[model samples]
Target: MRSIPSHHRLILAVLAGACLALASPAIGQEAEDGLEIGDAPAIMPVDPSDAGEIERGARPSSSTGDANRLDRGERDSAPPVTKGDKPMVGGEPDALQGINIYLRMGTPLPDVPPEKPYEGEPDTAYGAFQRGLFLTAVDRALPRAQLGDPAAQTLLAEIMSRGLGVKRDLKGAAFWYGQAAQGGDPAAMFKYALLLMEGKEVPQDREKADDYMRRAADAGNASAQFNWAQILVAGTPGVRGLTAAMPYYEKAAEQGIADAQYALAQVYSALKDVPAEKKARAREWMTRAARAGFDTAQLDMGLWLVNGYNGPRDYEAGYRWLSIAAARGNVVAQNRLAHLYINALGTAPDPIEAAKWYVLSRRAGLKDPGLEDFYLGLTEEQQKQAIDRANRFRRT
Candidate 1:
């Protein structure tokens, strides 16, 4: 319940969009029209605060007040396309738009309920919470929470921590989270463990935090599984922790956690004790993470594909993935993309494209004398075009 930093909030917003965008890549495949790749719309970053508004499906507030507002997910008017607006060419909306780069580092998004059909009866507290009636949710949940209902306790913790309809109460929130964790709520255990680790309104207790994290992981919390794997891998000596961490990492990875996938890839690649088959598993997991829009994983996967490591060589796939990562601001990917373009490895030779990527990589503080020489050898017109492209990429 510590005051969240602005950067954290921004990261949360990015993850919100990314979760929506990368939930399934197959969904995006259906939306790829015949439009040229250059015509693909750039993913615009959503403001973290505005993500809340989007989640609630609320309309923009107007001076005229509530009368003009629409219901959840209802639009009052269509957005007018401006001169520079990039509209979908001929298919469904691009689902991969707005993928966040933080997924590469394995940060999990905040736990939120996925959309599902309601069964018999809806929990009133949860219903009220969903509608943004925070006070009503608190009123409905307080009694149950007091009565030792673990779910209600967790709900109260979430509400209090966010100051949804009450004053911010870090201590109270932490207390409720701990209570819920003790009652065997996996989400609560994860939350409480984080608070314990951060020492926010609670005493720092790494041992207790580790315990809660393990419990949460055992209970199938994907974030907890990934975090516990990290703890095991980092805390245990030699190969013992790494060996112990593998199952948890696999569990999280199977649940579509990109960080876990990347971690597993690293383990399989680096662990000399791992069997050849397991090393092959590493390549598969790396591909999965890369396809999930993890930039670092994308870079590694691109290189792997190019080199045919543990698989058939696929230069085209490598080039495509590298270009995607480079466009998302990965310096390594940018440099690699330049190299690929210059050498015509996976793509048709395009010195201008290579020079443009080289310029972009150089601007990011990556020094490469070979790239510099190649870029300098370009014709003046080609150099101008590359410069223009580089500038355009930055502006977008």
Candidate 2:
């Protein structure tokens, strides 16, 4: 393992501390609202397993602690990572990254109670608002919102825009979101900005969204930082693009915001606009995000390893990571793995094995047109034989 530099350690520690501070309050508030902070997975350590179910890459990387490993349903009283060499997040690197180089498989989600607002001592306005969600409580929620209940205002906006508990009222939602944003709710600001951009509850005021996103990002909202970063990088449909958001992402990334770091790396890696020096810097940023446990970093790292981009070529290592990601049900990884197998990029040619993994990838919901159809063409007997063979290999 490479030694962590003292400067980097200090920076990482400071950033981690800030993230915990912010997440701590949110967790506490949620717990107070009837959800247990201890019940949710920590800010970091969102499971990659969901990647399969969601038809996307797995969840991003997390922080250093391994205190609790609560899944959506099941809870293990015991701690998840007890040993050294755990991934920067709570899972084993192999499990989270889908690389077989080191560590055991990650913990899977267990059956647990779904999150709900606390019932006892219910905030009545909130209660009525939630109960009437997009149906009947907009008026009640609006009054409470006017009285400075930020939460109520946010709820009213959500219901109006989504037509959930209230009538479909985009203007109403925008109004409420603006109110909530002015009340200093970062989430409200981000949502409001998004709605403004989409013209869902407001005019297609992209400039307004950019403004709100900037405010939310400045206030340390990770998702907002990421969205803002995307705009800054693309400079498409927005006045200020990557140039404006780069610093914001840096600030958020240093605060343990994985998405910001990932976005920073991506923007830096854009060969068309980025100079060689910037590309190098981007690789460094990518490494930082990867160390922090970003899933896209894992994929990017794997690609880099295979293509010798900003690093040495190592097909075996790349394949290991890709396989790990594929096992976790990342459709992209699965598709990539199929490509690797078909071309024998890093591993020995094994069409049967490739076919089996492809089938599993499809089951996991990958949406590659050619690969999907190709996998669909296999004879049932061939598929059965391939699966059985793959299973036997896995066991061995």
Candidate 3:
């Protein structure tokens, strides 16, 4: 078998980390008020191109970890990165970016179960509130809001923020959110934190925003936990920071946060000196994140399987995952996939296939000299076929 180049580990680690960072923070429990509120609403997804800061992970490169056979490749986990619609107070804001997601939060209508099935009217107001019946929700919730109901106050805030039934009143929504947040409502705390950061609806207050974000995280808001971990990671880059961020990441991951899952996999398998238990779970978490359509996770998964980082090598599985990420436009995956073909690690060696992947990755700005050499050696007819395949490829 032809030996693979060493630099690929660095390139692939970077590629995997970028994919692992994608995802939205957690929201409060989906079933609050006896209803499911999925991820607020999609005000719209922020462009995935806006990459967040690099995690200053103290962890060394993967444990002899590489995309394939660490002894030769020496790959490690890429530094954790994050992505978000961080609309700085001064910079152009993604006003429509993820604005309405907070409004999807729903809180439990009843704190205590009725002693008996005491026949009581169903709380339709909160129901209406979650159902986007803003006018009726406002009408019904106003009284309770006046009476100091935290959930009611939150409902009013959601309505005002979007001007769902009434005029958009950001300031007014901010006030109600403040009240509900102070009342210890997790939903309100999460929304308020985002608003504080955005600063367009109300005065920008980062200190307050951080405080509220932490509060929501503490109160089991999944989104808050993920973002809060981001804050902690940013504050202290390296192993200590990742260690500190673990608890929140764990919480968020359990709640099905794909980013957290990907992060956990990186720390457990690719980093050095972690507890055995954590490392044991790395493959499982990576699988979950990969299945969730996380392109980076897919890349990492391909590498891990082929390199046998956490377990025995499985070239076919590695090929499968690399193909998935490559199809999704992951440049690093495209490059590694080319290597897979040349080595015949899974499929039969096909120089044309190898050239095809190399062409795609090169087009996306990844310059691999080894691949270039290989591409140059191809016969003109083979190069034309490779180019034809590359040109025909599109992100799935």
Candidate 4:
């Protein structure tokens, strides 16, 4: 009899690399009316061990000390906003509060998942590449490539472009990529489009690039879909652009491109015209991206969880997510974490912890006058403790 391992446990083990604790994100918001939190435990130390588990792919143990401590998702509960409480991003009646993913989307564009690993030695050119016999890979690929084999052509292009056991030749790579693209290889189409856009390797052709990108995107290439969405949004900025790009983003997101997932979260959460069902899915996508190690998504996920945006708020889960992001050295999370510490929104009020986070964010060059005022109001001894904590803080 074959024994099946627990699937949920296995999934968590796989996702542990993303620092996922599986804290419940859908806990209902608790009221803030005279909330009695003075008796709550002080900001508990974030489990430093989870970071270590990320690389080892270990199953995360639940928060320690179950006797007196409240369950994680129920501790801070959720949205604690009262009559005068402000939204996290701080804008007027209607404004985009989610951290803008556009800020860094260009520099290191989202990459597609690499080709699936080989099970055993196959007589393919890629088998040679995988075995570190790059020269043999090129030798085996060239004749098949010449015979109009798209996969072989694509492999030859990759080897040439990357200079794997051969003199690098962008022009030659571009030619092979174009040949494979013409033969309807999705990956080749994408690579060729990039070369067309770069102009250094090939003559800059925006129209040609768009055509190839669109072709690759339609062929279900995940990176192509994400880049196509970006292209559409870049062509027309604002709500209209986002709305137009939604389909591409959704497709790419479903294919597990974290950037597209983050983009979907932003547009779905922001737009009033978005269906309630789709809007509710915003946090779901954001959480996936967050668990994929998109630090910005983690920061936004914390904010979304805390504010009950797109889903029920879960302040305890949000705090933990923020802690994860802060540990990852996200300056924005550090700033927001400081607020959570000071206000007792998730953890018990701890001015020293609050000031520690503020110092970290300040060192990262984010200026927050209100946090500054709060810092100045702290006692000298408290300030020293905060500074010391910040100095000793090393991202795990």
Query: Candidate 1 vs. truth: CA RMSD?
Result: 15.2
- Model 3 misplacement above 4 A: 1-122, 130-134, 160-172, 270-273
| Residue-level lDDT tens digits of model 1 in 176-275 | 8878888999999888877776664676777777788889999999888887776665565346667788898889899998878877786676566888
Residue 252 Cα positional deviation in candidate 3, in Å, after optimal superposition: 0.6
TM-score of each: 0.67, 0.46, 0.66, 0.67
Candidate 2 global TM-score: 0.46
Task: Give per-residue lDDT, candidate 4, residue 353.
Answer: 95
Looking at model 2, residue 106 earns an lDDT score of: 53
* Candidate 4, run of 10 with poorest lDDT: 35-44
Q: What is the C-alpha RMSD of each candidate to the true structure, in Å?
A: 15.2, 18.9, 21.8, 24.0
Instruction: Point out the worst 10-residue segment of candidate 1 by lDDT.
Output: 31-40
lDDT of 4 at 124: 62
**Best-fitting candidate, measured by TM-score?**
1
Give lDDT per model, in order: 0.69, 0.56, 0.68, 0.70
lDDT of 1: 0.69
Q: Which candidate is the best by lDDT?
A: 4
Worst 10 residues of 3 by lDDT: 27-36
Worst 10 residues of 2 by lDDT: 28-37
